[model samples]
Target: MTISANLALAYPEIILAVGALALLVLGAFMPKQTSLVATGGVAVLLAAAVASATQPFGVAFGGGLIADAAATFAKVAIYVASAVAIPLGQPWFERRGVKTFEFPVLILLSALGMGMMASSGDLISLYVGVELSSLALYVLAAMHRDNAKASEAGLKYFVLGALSSGLLLYGASLVYGFAGSTLYADIAKAAGAEANTGLLFGLIFVICGLAFKVSAAPFHMWTPDVYEGAPTPVVAFFAAAPKLAAMMLFARVLADGFTDAVAQWQQVLVALALISVAVGAFGGLVQKNLKRLWAYSSIANIGYAVLGLASGTSEGVQAMLVFMILYMVDVTGFFACLAALSRQGKAMETIDDMAGLVKERRGLALAMTVFSLSALGLPPFSGFWAKYVVFKAAIDAGLWGPAVIGLVGSVVAAFYYLRLIKVMWFDGSAGATDKPPMEAKAIGLTAAVFAFPVVLVAITWLNPLAARAAQALGLA
Candidate 1:
């Protein structure tokens, strides 16, 4: 491809990269321009979304990046999620008497990196994308510098994230050495012809590193703390966009680069899925902190998504894409509800803090209820359909044993969601929470409506779109 054509293929990423730098400069030179910077950041993301939707599909950057249906789908979602997050942080920081334009800029940069990840066509690009996103997240985790827990969260994430990066780089080197190239197409050709022990080892290490990014079990120690300590708005973004980006990158690396070795990687994914489901289901039962509980909830949900990937079929990938999109809505809305509520100027962090929420803030309580039910996979809610398709995909791929275990895990996870709902509606008043911010309330209620009636309509289009994106993975 010509240089101009490659640049055109990367228009969405260019918008984000250039816009972030512009916003950063504007914020530095201009005083008290946080709100303007934030607004600008959202505009940039929306522009990128439009660019992503319109970009033609093709290999670019010497096959180091790809603009395909899957990349377009993921990039648009990542941009929208990041856009929502910018407004969310503005009100949150204002309440605490802290004002900085860096938050939105960092989110923009992170979204830029995530866009790269979704489009990555080679190991080098994958590593670059991962680091770009991770560095911004490390800073964001500790954006509340005055808070000890926030600092601690940032430190832990940085340390563990660095370790994962090391593993990734080492694996990438090994893969390069064994396959004689870093491009996924090259690796796929090499693996298809003859799967070697060295290449498989490298693949295993790479999976471990990506698994950490998704907060799958055994590497999930940082999630609960980070979610509990980071600003709620940041956590909302963390729970939604990055998860989908990492999973799409994961699907691409495996499905596009290692399809011939499905038998090898499928076993590894199966183990991660079952372990994550078990830990997320049982571990959450003992949590008192609401954020920590949701952290576990995210872990289990990722497990289900990973289960779909484990099936190693195009249908499985389609189910995974649909499931992640739906789950992102439910999770983001849940965190937004949390961000909206407070009691006596203190944030609500524990389960007991939500006691009798329906009495004081019926709208928030109702939104929370809808999100909880949808997350629990109850009938008529979006989460139910998400799980149904994932389970169906697994069964169709002849993964009945893992599918059954995943179903049981969902049943076990129900207790925590039900407990949360019960506390909100039935328990005695813990005292009225301050009136929620307009942005948080709007996002929460909108997500709730989507989780129900709108989802019924959404699936009509989402299902076919997801199938097309999955087909782009070339996983027959």
Candidate 2:
């Protein structure tokens, strides 16, 4: 490919990279202008999203990267999620005395990695993208240098993230050594023609690495601590966009690169899904900190998504996209609401803090209720549709046992969400204040806007977008 053509194929990533560097330099010279930097970063992301949408699909850089329909859709979703997360972080950053230009720049850089992951067609490029994103996230987690919790979260994430990356790199090396190529297409051809033991070992290791990235069970130990200790806005970002990018990569690596290895990977995916569902459902039941509860909730939700991918069919991919889109909205909204819930300028952190929340900030309270119910996969809500599509896909693929297990996990998870509602509506304040800080109204409004889809998704035109996403992946 010509230089211009490769640049065109990677236009969004180029824009993001340039924007991040500019923002970094600008922030250095004008330390007090961090907000402006953030605004500019968001505008850059929006522009990149548009560019990504308009770009033509094809292999670029000798098949190391691609700009296909699926990649475009996933890139756009990540951009939107990252954009939404920016403003939500503002209040927390200010309160923690951590407001700086680095935060937005890091997010943009991380997003660049996510975009690369979505577009990557080779193992080397995919590994590069994962590390770029993970490194940014590690810094973001520890942004509040003065906070012990933040420091701990960052250190733990860095350690575990590095370990996972090493595993992934080792797997890539094994695959390359055995198949004599790093391009997914070449690897696919090689694996399909011969059942090489080294290749099988490499595939399993790669799955393990990706599984850790998604916070799947047995590899999810870092999630609760990271989620609980990181700043709320950062946690919100952590819970949504990065996971979507990683999952998209997961689906692509399996469906596009290892299609012939379906029997080999399917059982592994099912086992991870089942274990995640069980752990997430039971783990949240005893949590006092709301963030920790949400962490466990995220784990279970990932299970539902993986179950969809376990089918290894276009319908399954479509179902996974549906589940993830709705999941993103609910998770982002829930955290936005939590970010808005402040008493005497400090953000609320526990179930008790939510006591009598309905009496004041009714809008936030109601949004929270809807989001909680949606997270539980209740009917008439988008979350219900999300789970339904995935569950149906699993059953259709003759995985009735996994489907039933998912349904049971949903039922168990509903208890904690209901408990949150009960505390907000029926319990006493127990000395916690109810008034949201003056800065929180915007966060509350953001939460409300996202909450709309939770109830209206079934009736709204958004249903078609899910179909479009399916088509993007050639699944519809």
Candidate 3:
């Protein structure tokens, strides 16, 4: 592809790359104020998002990148999530005396990876995007260098990530050997002509790689350890936009490129979905750390997300998109509250730490309650509707068993979420409470700003933009 064509198609990534570099350099000269760094980073990302929205290449770079509705919509959601997360991290960064510039640059770099992954039209480009994103995260996870746990988490993630990357490359090689192309649309065409061992082996390896990224069960061993060890903001990042991007890529590849091999990959995805749901729902029960709990929650949520892909339809993808946005809002809100609860540079880790939180910080505790409930799929919340859409899609596709299992998983998942609530509401007796610190207020305000509207978007069916974006992306 010509440079102009590539730039036109992936202008957002280009802008983001520049933004990351600018933040890296200017951030060094700028004052150490974290708020300034965060807001600056957010402004740059928002600008890139706006530019991407207006750009109309449609498909550029010889189909190596796509600029359709799906990619655009995912970018929009990612930007919004980053916007929400930036302020949420301000206090956390300041508390730890971390470098402001590095934080925002890492965030931008991660977003760049997500943007490229969303637009990638070929397997090679997709791997590049995933690696770019993952590398940023590995550093971010261990940014707390003084903390031994954080360093260990980063090391574990890097090692496992290397294995996953190798598996993915081997799979891609097998797929290309069988199909004669790595471009998704071309591979889809090639795979439809015949069935063979090479195709199955390639797809199986590919699924295995993606499964690890998405934290599917049997491959999710890293999650709880990583989440527990990483900084809370870093953990929050994992639970939000990055999860959405990776899962979306998983769905897109399977639904678009491997559509012809639905039967073969579907079995793998279904088994993965079931196992993840089981592990995520149950594995969180014994967690002492809130971050670890959310890690398992993420695993289960991806199970719900993957259900859409197993349906093998555009409607399924649409439902998955909606589910992802909803998941992002709720998860982000929870972490915001978690960040808010931290005092004296100490984060809230155990459920007991939240004892009498409602009494301590009324507005924030209430907001956290709402977020937790929504995540559990309770009525009148965004999460309820997110799961509702996916559940309905599964039913329509006649995957009633998985749908029912998902509902059951939701209920089990509710146990830990409610455990959080119970600690805040009923489990602990009321006591004299201290007013939350300034940092807590900032994080609370940030989360509340985005979360309430997200819930309204679910209950009222009011947002045409999301639906339109989904449609444009060939989702429904």
Top candidate when judged by lDDT against the true structure = 1
Which stretches in model 3 have alpha-carbon errors above 4 Å? 29-36, 343-345, 429-454, 458-476
Per-residue lDDT of model 3, residues 1-476, tens digit only: 66887677777888889888877777778757556777788998898889778888567777778887778878877876776667666657666776556878888999999888888788888898899999998988888888999999999999998898898889989888988888988888887888777877998998898888878887888888998888876777888888888877886677667777877887777788888899999998998788888889989988988887677667677778888888887787677667666544466678878888876677878888888888888877778888888888788988899999988998988989988888888756445444455654666555665555546754455235445544554223
Clashes of 2: 0
lDDT per residue as tens, model 1, 1-476? 79999999999999999999999999999849899999999999999999999999999989999999999999999999999999988779877977888999999999999999999999999999999999999999999989899899899999999999998889888888999999999999988988588999999999999999999997898999999989899899999999999999999999988989999999999999999999999999999999999999999999999999999999999999999999999999989989999998999989999999999999999999999999899989999999999999999999999999999999999999999999999999999688889999899999899999999999999999999999999699
What Cα-based lDDT does every candidate model obtain? 0.94, 0.86, 0.79
Q: 1-476, model 2: which lDDT tens digit per residue?
A: 89998899999999999999999999999999978988988898999999999999899999889898788888998998887777677556876677688888999999999999988899989999999999999999988889899999999999999899988899889989998999988988888998888998898889889989999998999999999999888998999899999998998788777878888889999999999999999999999999999999999999999999998777888788778878888888788778777787666899988998888767788888988988898876778888988999999999999999999999999999999999999987655554654444555556556555534644355456555655655222
Clash count list over all predictions: 0, 0, 2
Model 2: how far residue 416 lies from native, Å: 0.7
TM-score, predicted candidate 1 vs. hidden true structure: 0.99
Using TM-score as the measure, which candidate wins?
A: 1
Local error of candidate 2 at residue 65 (angstroms): 0.9
Q: What's model 1's overall lDDT?
A: 0.94
Better of 1 and 3 by TM-score: 1
Scored by lDDT, model 3 comes in at 0.79
